[model samples]
Target: MSQHIALLGSTGSIGTQVLDVVRHWPGRFTIAALGAGKNLERLAQQTGEFHPRCIAIQQESDLPALRELLNVHAPAFSGEILVGKAGLNAIAESSVSALVIVGLVGLAGLEPTLKALYAGKRVLTANKETFVTGGHLVQPYLDRVIPIDSEHAAIHQCLKNEPVKAVKHILLTASGGPFRTFSAADMQKVTLSQALKHPNWVMGHKITIDSATMMNKGLEVIEAHWLFGVSYDQIQVVVHPESMIHSGVEFVDGSILLQMGAPDMRGPIQYAMTYPERLPNPEPKVHLDFLSLSRLNLEPPDLERFPCIRLAYEAGRLGSGATAVLNGADEMAVQLFLEEQIDYCAIPKLLEAALNAHRQESTPSAPSLSDIHALDDWARRFVREQANPLTARSTG
Candidate 1:
């Protein structure tokens, strides 16, 4: 049976990979709707090909330009073009699509995700921030969320109808980033270009940097807690420099189930789309010879070397809107660093400060949709106010 898919963030790395899946297995899935931010040109191209019933863009000002582009190239396309937050929410609640594939960055995906879940759509998401900040609130409505992140997806596959209690813990693996062997002093002198080069998977600039800081793993920890209903202590991050062994789940009997594959996003993306029924791999099948590669090294994450991971654990333990603050501040800090306004090492410093401030101000409980989003705003503002000009700071 063919399924309708709402391809949110259709122009992004994850979104494009999803399109690749759709393109390869066009009979299995059809594009019902699409959403993107500030990339109208690419959106227009996608619209021309997929011809979704409706589409969404981030800014209201982007609407006219998108319309003009669509008119010139995709003249026969009859879908409604919507704009801004309300538009995104509207698309999510449209019910025209049974599956909403969220690839948008940050907390921008929160409201739309809830809307889709409430609308009874199976949401497949690569948006980790949505889970990180809104997990406490979104859990009740989520029945079938496909984790598109390779590690989480691996864990999900490993679980496969198994009893949750039978599982001992989840081992989330990391690529150890580009500067895996670099000293703290060396990291401080790192440039944006160097930090963005992920040694394993090809990803967006923000996520690549997050991996470098191990903050991506940090955020993933929070996501895992919510996704699997596991405690912080049950989730562990290990450095897997080779990028094989996406993740593993250890059972109570000490038997560990591992999901090994080449570092390919499409593998997980297609896994989520086709669901319980496995789809044949569409990406370039990377050959991995375990015998020749020698041993796979697993080591505990160095919290002293990478403080963001510790900060993530701390914020998660603090509960409430603390994770929201960490994400908000990190976004600001990452943007600043990308723009050459801040040093690489300052990312976690700024995030830690913001987390501390949010902990002081927020209640020790899960926040509502509006409350979390409001806290997201407040956190961004706090990071901006705390910016130190001489050193790296939030908001370029």
Candidate 2:
């Protein structure tokens, strides 16, 4: 009785690590389907190995090229091919997979997540943007939605068999990224390569940038609010450069329970894939001698230095539409920065302007899917429209 898994974003950092986990356990899990972006070569390789019953591509124009690669690489792949957003939804709604892993980045993961939950499939989500944007829509399905982010996964483990009411606060640990010691003046001149050099983990470029700005932590804050049924005030961000303590829960009785592990995405991926069942690590990387450890410094996140976190908190508190705008703005701003169109500091400024615009516009408290998408579109456009002015101000 193998558990079938439908993995979206099959070629991403998280998706590849998930495959590593599945590869370790022979018959425990199976890849029933795969949904990938534009990496046909890697997708074909995965299809050849995993032999999923169905596969999806982000663009229809890539289908012929994908088929040619599959013909040469995965000649045995007879799986039904699907294309575009419809294909992603088809994968989510497919009857073969019992669990769906939403590994796709940004707003792309939200609809498929909803489809999977509505189709009675348990969803293990690594995409924080889903919750940040559509927390209200996904609230009723919280039991079916599992968090794959390291911080949320750690807090989920700590709260097991524990009363939610008794929990006082959630202390999510951050690596403080590569810019922890960087002053405001230093950050103004931060290069693209410098921002991508995350201190602890290797992740996708978007997330790596978010980490550098501490915006990833901000997104996690909103995500934790939805996943754990907690308020913004109850969640605190602690800058722990070591990343040893994944996250912690403080109880009302003055006791704190923490889940500590090596800096690895596979740890949480494996845990979510096989919940309530802890298995032996296939390959242990770091062995810790707790008594001989020298230093584990923990401090508060600097709101002034990393204002993205502040923007995230304000957005989360504002409501659904604002969070959607924040996420959309961040995505566009990150892209602009990566392309050298905007400096690193302009990222947060764009986000702030988008949030302000969203505040001025009339927004629904509980927006529908269509409404979320509309808000996302507006935010991206707003950021693009404002990027030039922000960039000039930052550089001039």
Candidate 3:
């Protein structure tokens, strides 16, 4: 029997790859529901192909256009159409599927993910921010949430059935982005195009930027802390430009286990979708071409250049609303940098200021969902305010 699943962010980089997986194993998966943000054309194409029982859009304003597109493209789709956050939450809570794939970006993914877990649905998620911002809420439901990110998924594969005590530490690999070889002076002048040109993998703009700053790896470190029951110190980041060895685990006995494959998100997405069971992949599979490859390099990350990683470690250790603030600040900072409002170098500065401000404020040590959301909002505002002066100086 095919497993039924609901996919949020159905038109994204992860979502499209997931669809590719579904196409590969036609009878293995079913799309019960689909959700996306501002990409009605692609969403409609997916709906036409998959014919999910329900569909969701990010804004109410996109509803009419979506319906028209559905009419032209997926005229046979008689399913329900839901709008905004409420619609997303409804899909997460509904019984349309037993598994929910969260491809939604940023903080928008947190509530729906929480809702799905609470409603007893297993969640296969690629959204690192969900864990970075609200890992506390999701931690109790760890049994049901499977990570779909390549790094965490690689660790998940490596650590399967291995005793926690046998482990020494887990290593999360980083591609080191486009600026890995760049000097400190070179980093200050990097343009948006340069930052988005990732060396190994092709991803969405937001994540691509995060990768350039090494903040994606930083966020993954926080997620790994929550996904696997490990301390911040137990997780190490090695700059692996090849991206072939997704991640690894070292045992106390000096043995190491690593998961290696082509730099493809589909491999992890498929693993998460059909876990505990390995199935035959579609044509043009993802695997290492060691015969054609040469050497893999590993180096320590430069903290002086990419301070986001250092900031993430500090926030994860602080343990309160700090991680939430860290994620929120980075999201806004990345956006400002993408929009040319701030220099690439200013991303870390904005994040540090937000974390500092959050520490000084009186906040709950054990924050509720509301508290996390509030802190996220506060951090965004803090980053914007901090970036304004920089924007002014740049314009001047």
Candidate 4:
């Protein structure tokens, strides 16, 4: 049976790749609904080609132009909708869609994710901040929460069919970004362009910078804890510069299971979209011979150099508003760094201050959706205050 899909963030890196998967296996899947940010032209083209039952755009003003464009060509597409809280709700609750692919960046993806889960749709997620910021709100509603990020996908595949108690530890691998060897003093001079130049993967700008500071790995650590029901200590981050071994899981029997593949998002994307069954696609295959598959190297991530990863583990262990604070603070810090308001090295420093200021809740309970929003607002305000002492004093 063909699986119908509602794809949020339809113009993003993961969304576009999802389209590729749909194109290759036309008979196996259907694009029932689609949504995107302000990329109207791409949205228009996607609507024109795929002819989804419904479409949503982030900017309300773009709706008229989009509707007109669809009217002229795909007039049967009378189902297009203006993307907002209601639009997200409609797409998540659509009866035809069995699963929702949420590739949206940052906290913007959080609400829709919860909506989908509550509506009883399986969620194939790439938005780390959703789990980082509000998994407590979404986890109980989930029947299946699949990972779309390669590392998490690798860990997911590795741990399949194994009892949670039998697992020793989950080893999440990172490529060490573009500055693996740079000293703390050297990071102070790094530019936005330098941080965006990721060595192993081509990803969105915010995530590229996060990788440089190891904040992406930090977010993933929290995500793994939520997704796998593992303790913070049970999850490990290893600096695997080769980028070949996606992730590994060591069991209680001392046997290690590893998932290795070329650094391609499509592999995992396809896996999640067609779970319990693998579909054949013409995407590039991993050729071990041409790349010279030598021995895999792994080492402990340096907490002194990549303190963001350390901060994430601390937040995950604390388990309250901590992950929410870490995510919100890092989001603000990344924006500030990109805008040249702060140096790359200062990103972790700002995140640490925000996390430290937060008082861990005693007898922590799962946060409500409102609580997640409040924590995000508080964390952003705290980070901005630290970034500008004048603002801090005025508020004080």
Candidate 5:
């Protein structure tokens, strides 16, 4: 029987690629539901193609606009159209599908993921922030929430049903962004365009910028900690420019297992979508000749250059609301940098200030999903208000 899937963030980078995977294997899977942000044009197009049983939009006010678009593009899609969190939960908890993919970016992904877990659905997700902020809530269902990110997926494959104690440590590989070779002086004058130009992978703007600053790897480190039950110290980050050896695990026996593939998100997406099975890729297959010619390299990340990474380790070690604040701050900082409201270097400084302020909060309460959201909001505001001074520091 074909598996039914509920897809969140169906219009974004990973979402679109996931749709491609479904399109590739029409015999193995069917789209039961879909969710998107405000991209009604793309949503309408997807609805026209997949005709999901139900659809949800992030912006409720855009419902009329979406309805109009669907009338033209998907005149036949009479499935339910829900709005906001209510709609998100409706599809997340929908009984028609047992598999849910949560790709919604940032804090927006947390609630719906929790809803799906509550509904006992097997979730495969790219939303690192969901685990970054509310990992404890999702911890109870660790077996059900599989990772779709390449690094985590690679680690998942390497473990291969082995006990956690059997592992020595996991190495989370990074492309080191476009700024890997750049010095502090070079970063000081960096612009939005340079940061967005990732050396290898093409991704959404926020992630591309996060990659430039290595904050994406840091967030992945936190996610790996939750996903693999490893300490921050046990999970290592090695800068691999080739991105061929996606990631690896070194067991206590000294034998390392590495999952290698093309630098394509679709590979990992398909892996999570079809667990315990491999798909015959239609196009863009990895060429052994091309890979054989490329030389792989690894190096330690420079803390002096990428302070966001340092903040991530500190936040993760702090063990409560700190990681949540760190994620929220980076999300807002990346937006500010993208808009040119702050220099590329100020991204780290802005994150530092937000983390500092969050530490001084009148009371650091116990971990709660709601508190994580509140901390996320507070961190965004804190960073925005402090942007001017940090930008001054960057240009000074």
Candidate 6:
């Protein structure tokens, strides 16, 4: 049975890899809809190739050109759909698709993800912000949420067939970014280019910076708590300089299960897209022989050096709007760091302030999608107003 897919953020790194997976297993999947943020050329090429029923672009200004391009080949193509409120609904509610891949980065991906889940579409998710900001809104609808991130995918695979209660702990591994060896005092002088140079992964600018500051691990910790019904304490972050061991699960019987592979996004992406069944693809193979699989090292994350990871665990424990604040604040902080509006070390300080300001709403009913949006907006504004250079201190 071919799975029909609605791929939101079709122009992104993860989104493009998803298309690669589909292309490899042509008979196994179909693209029902495609959406992207302002990358009209790539979006147009995807639309032409996939012949999806609907396509969405972020900017309304790009619509006219996209529509004309589409009309030249796909004559029935109307104006390019804008992916605001309605486009999100359209992709989720599209009758043709069985699964929606929500790969949009940052908090922007949250609403569309909820819409897809609530509309009964299985979601292959790569965006950490979706769960970080609004898991409460989407948890009730999680019968179909599949993880596409490698670490989460590893956990998912390890936990299969095992009772959730039988799991003793989850070990979420990190590559420790480019600055794994840098002391806390040295991080203050780090440049943007230095931070962007990730040691193990090729990712977008925002995520690369997040990984450098260990904020990516922080976000993953939040993602782990939601994906697995585990407490914050049950989830552990270990810095594995080599990215080979994606993640691990320790059972109650003291047996540890680990998933190891080359650091490739397609492995997990393909798994989520063609789930419950495996398909063959000629992507790069994980060769343990020539690669020298000699040693695998694990160390406790240096929370003093990487406060963002600590802040994430704190927010995870608090629940409520805490994750929303952490996610929203970090998003803005990362943007600021990238723009040189703030120094490299200030990212977590800003996130910490936002988390402190957040007041947990009482055993609140499942948050509405709009409620999450509002909190995200509030966090961004709060960080911008309160973040200061002096507060940015060395992690040590």
Greater lDDT among 1 and 4 belongs to: 1
List TM-scores for all candidates, in order.
0.96, 0.97, 0.97, 0.93, 0.95, 0.92
Tell me which of candidates 1 and 2 scores higher on lDDT.
2
Span of ten consecutive residues with least summed lDDT in model 5: 282-291
Please provide, for model 3 over 1-396, each residue's C-alpha lDDT reduced to its tens digit, 9 standing for 90 to 100: 999989999999999988998998888899999989999999999999998999999899888899999998899999999999999999999999999999999999999999999999999999999989889889999989889999999999999978778888999999999999999999989999999899999988999999999999999999999998889989999999999999999988999999998888888988898898887655465667888778889999999999999999999998848999999999889989888989899998889889888888888766898999899888987888788966545544
lDDT of 4 by residue, 1-396 (tens): 778899999999889998999998878888899988887778778888888888888777777887777766676776757577678767877786978999899988998888888787899999989889887776676457899999889988998877789989999999999999898788778888999999988888889999999999999998888888788889989999988889989899999998887787888999888887876644856444536775777888999999999899888887757888889999989988888888888899999998888864342446777787788888888888889778657765
Candidate 4 lowest-lDDT run of ten: 281-290
Order of candidates by lDDT, top first? 2, 3, 5, 1, 4, 6
lDDT of each: 0.86, 0.91, 0.91, 0.85, 0.87, 0.83
Question: How far does residue 259 in candidate 5 sit from its true spot (Å)?
Answer: 1.2
TM-score of candidate 1 against the unseen true structure: 0.96
Model 6 misplaced regions, further than 4 Å: 68-80, 285-291, 359-366, 388-396
Candidate 6, residues 1-396: lDDT per residue as tens digits? 777899988999899999998898877789888888877878887887888888887766776887877766566555336566578667777786878998889988887887777777789899998888887777777668989989999999999868779988999999998988998889889999999899888988888999999999999998888888888889989899988889989999999999888888989998887678776543856443535777888888888988989998888888747788788888889988888888988888888878877854443434566676777778888777766534433211
Candidates arranged by TM-score, highest first? 2, 3, 1, 5, 4, 6
TM-score of 3: 0.97
Candidate 3 C-alpha error for residue 97, in Å: 0.4
Better model by lDDT, 2 or 4? 2
Deviation from native of the Cα of residue 343 in model 4, angstroms:
1.4
Candidate 1 vs candidate 3: the TM-score winner is 3
True lDDT of residue 283, candidate 5: 51
lDDT of 1 at 156: 94
CA lDDT for candidate 6: 0.83
lDDT of 5 at 192: 82
Task: Encode model 2's per-residue lDDT on 1-396: one tens digit a residue.
Answer: 899999999999999999999999999899999999999999999999999999999999998999999998899988799998999999999998979998899899999999999998899999999999898889999988879999999999999868679889999899999999998999899999999899899999999999998999999999999999889999999999999889999999999999888888888998998898988775676544577658898999999999999999999889988898899899989988899988999898889889987898899978899999899888877888787766645654
Which ten residues in a row are the worst by lDDT in model 1?
387-396
lDDT of 1 at 218: 97
